[model samples]
Target: MTKDQLKLRSLILTALFAAIIGIMAQLFIPLPLVPITGQTLAIGLAATILGSRYGTISVLLYLAIGAAGVPVFAEFSGGVSKLVGPTGGYLIGYIPTVFIMGLYLEKTSFTIKNAMIANTIGMIITLIFGTAWLKIAANLSWTAAFMTGFMPFIIVGLVKAFLASWIGILTRQRLISAKLLFPERLKEKDNKVA
Candidate 1:
């Protein structure tokens, strides 16, 4: 394919991944303060596969879609109210997560081990934002916020982080090997015969 065509394809795929993250967010298991879900898994996966810039843009697009009154959020709900509500912190937390995960993935080699570590750190950062925001919004103590918004998600988040990282990195590696992306450096080492 031509270079311009390749860029267009990449843009389309990035947008599709963003939409996927938004859709996956619907699988929410409601909690007291912040509903827990595999949404972060999607975010991590986006970051790993798309790298930092595209991944972050995808998340921003997802947020924009939700903000524009699309019912794409958890429980098929969306509006400005949700964006500014008590759970808003968690929603906003997603932005930084994309940056954190994507930026880390950009700098590091893709591997199961690296993916796990990077995703773990990213998730922790997101949880910190989510829980802290919950604390302030709900007027709860730190302990209370942890119990409601952060504690319940600890085990599951860890598992999802690792799993998502693995899947995303693996898929991206395959895509690079297939020459789906233009720049050869985008591929993982094994795919480059040179």
Candidate 2:
């Protein structure tokens, strides 16, 4: 594929993943501090499939859409208020989460173990940002922030990370086989040690 083709294909995939994140955001159980959401699963899936650059772009696009007042956040919430609201940090946390996950998969061969490791690390980063943000945004104690934002979501996060690792890698493999995500999708930058 030409450079333009590669760029276009990546953009399309990025847009698709952004929509996936938006859709997944709606599938949630609302809570006072933070909603139980599938957004992270979708983020993991996007990172695994699109790799770091495009994955992060996809997440940025998702945030931009939500901040622009589109109803693409949890419980169909959107607008700049939502981005600055109590749960905003969790949303902000996705930046590093998707970037690191995709960067790891890009550098290493994709495997169940590697995928899980990437996703788990990503989740931890999200939790750190989210929990901290919960405390500041909601005016809660650290313990309250942890309990409301981190503790309750631990099991669910693990499950989502596992599911994302398994399903994302499999789906990416299939797409590669089908040629839609070939070439660029499997690219590893040539590194020469001097």
Candidate 3:
């Protein structure tokens, strides 16, 4: 594809992922301090499929939409209040989580193993941000934060991480085959081979 076509494809895919994140955010099992939402799964998929640049852009777009009071957050919450709310850290943390996950895959390989590692790390990063913010925002003690925010989600997060990595790699491979997404590393390898 030409440069303009590629840019348009990126833009469309970015917007689609952003919408996917928002939709996934709505699927939540409500907890006392925080809800376990499918947002993380979508985030993982975005990174694994879109890589660093477009993945991060998709996350930012999702956040911007939520910040604009579009009710795209978990439990149908939104606006700047939600951004600065107790769960705000988790929301904000998606940025680095997606970026690092995508960057990790980009630097290494877009295999299931690498995606698993990246998603696991991304899960930890999100929990750290969420737990820390939950402590301060809710005025809870460290132990309380750890117990409420961090402990409960470990197993669930691990499951989600696995799902993301497995599904993500499969989907990414298909997309690459279909020419919907192209990895820079693959391009470089092609050029070198040529």
Candidate 4:
């Protein structure tokens, strides 16, 4: 398949996944500031499968949609207000996390053994930027900021990361196998990668 076809298909899939992630925001746990949702799982899945470029684009597009007043954020929240809210930093952090996770997925061979490690590292990246942004935006000290913004979601993040990594590895394997063994999707696009 041609690179262009692959890029287009990847972008479409990424956008679909972004919408799915946004919709998952409806399943939220109440807490201080931002509630937890299953969105990050989709973010990780996109990064692992689509690589950095399209994966990041997917996330950016999702945020743009939300910022444009689409109810695509957690708790059915959207618009510019949500972007400037306390959780905005965390929302923004998703962009870099997905990109970095994609880099890891591409650079290192994905295996069950490394999945947890990769997820942990990626989670840390998200939290760092998120926590820092939360601090500045909320005008709180680092400790207080982390307690309010980061602590509440640690357990949930771990659970979702585990699930994301597992699913990511499985999905990647399936896609690679399909692309190589079947190539039907490629043939439809005239043997293009997309």
Candidate 5:
């Protein structure tokens, strides 16, 4: 493909992943402070499949849409208010979480093992951001925040991480084989020492 064609494809895929994140956000088991949602899994999938640049772009687009009052957040909520709300930290944290996850895979290899590690790390990052913000935003003690915000999600987060890794690697490989995604060789070259 030409440069413009590649750029267009990346943009399209990025927007599609953003939409996927929004859709996944709706699949939540509600909690008092924060809901456990499929958003994290989608974020992982984006990173694993799209790599750092497009993956992070997808996350940024997702956040921008939520911040613009699009009702794309968990429980069908959205707006700048949601971004600054008690649970907003988790939402905001998605940016770094997806970026780092993608960067890890980009620097290493887009294998299931690497994706799992990256997703696990991403999960921890999200929880930390959420817990810290929960403490401040909800006026809860650190202990309370840990108990409520962090603890409840540990097992569930691990499950999601596993799912993201397994599914993401499989899908990425398929996409590359089908020429829908840029090949892994290209990704390696993109990260080669200069």
Candidate 6:
């Protein structure tokens, strides 16, 4: 593909992933502290499939859309107020979450171990940001915030992370087969061979 063609394709893919995140957000199980949503799964998919740069771009785009008063968040909620609401921390946390996952998958071969570790780390960072935000935004005590935000979601988060890791690596393999990924990676391999 030509340079411009490659750039266009990348742009389209990034936008698609951003849309996926937005759509996935609508699938939420509302809870007291935080909504159990498919956002993390989409985040994992985008980062694993697109890698750091494009994954980060996709997430930023998703946030921008939501910040623009679009009803794209969980339970079809939206607007800038959502960003400052109790759940806003989790929304913002998606940025760093994608960065960690994408960076790890970008540099290393996808494996259950790698994906789980990276995802676990990312989930921790996201929860920390989320819990802190809950305390400040909702005026809750640290223990309260932890109980409400962190404690409730641990097992589900692990399950989602595991699913994301498995699905992401599998999707990447399909992308490679379709010639939609691994050009640069293949080039690196060829360079080593030569």
Best-fitting candidate, measured by lDDT? 3
lDDT of 1 by residue, 73-130 (tens): 7888788787787777777888888787767655766666667877898888888888
Clashing pairs in 5: none
Determine which window of 10 residues in candidate 2 has minimal summed lDDT: 185-194
By TM-score, the candidates rank as: 3, 5, 2, 6, 1, 4
Error (Å) of candidate 5 at residue 97 is: 0.5
Q: Which candidate wins on TM-score? A: 3
lDDT of 3 by residue, 3-109 (tens): 88878887898999999999999999998889999999999999988988999999999999999999899988889999888999999999999999999988877
* Higher-lDDT candidate of 1 and 6: 6
My TM-score estimates for the predictions, one after another, are: 0.90, 0.93, 0.94, 0.85, 0.94, 0.92
- Model 3 Cα shift for residue 41 (angstroms): 0.6
* Candidate 6 structure lDDT: 0.82
What is candidate 6's CA lDDT for residue 75?
88
Query: When superposed on Cα atoms, how far off is each prediction in RMSD?
Result: 2.7, 4.1, 3.2, 5.4, 3.5, 3.4
Model 2 clash pairs are: none
User: Model 2: what TM-score?
Assistant: 0.93
Q: Write the per-residue lDDT of candidate 6 for residues 1-194, one digit (tens) a residue.
A: 78778777778889999999999998889897789999988988887777778889999999999999888889887889999999899989989889988788667656666777778877887889899999999999999999998998889889988888778777766776686664355423221200
Rank all candidate structures by their lDDT, best first, as comma-separated numbers. 3, 5, 2, 6, 1, 4
Instruction: After superposing candidate 4 on the true structure, give the runs of residues whose Cα lies further than 4 Å from its correct spot.
Output: 180-194
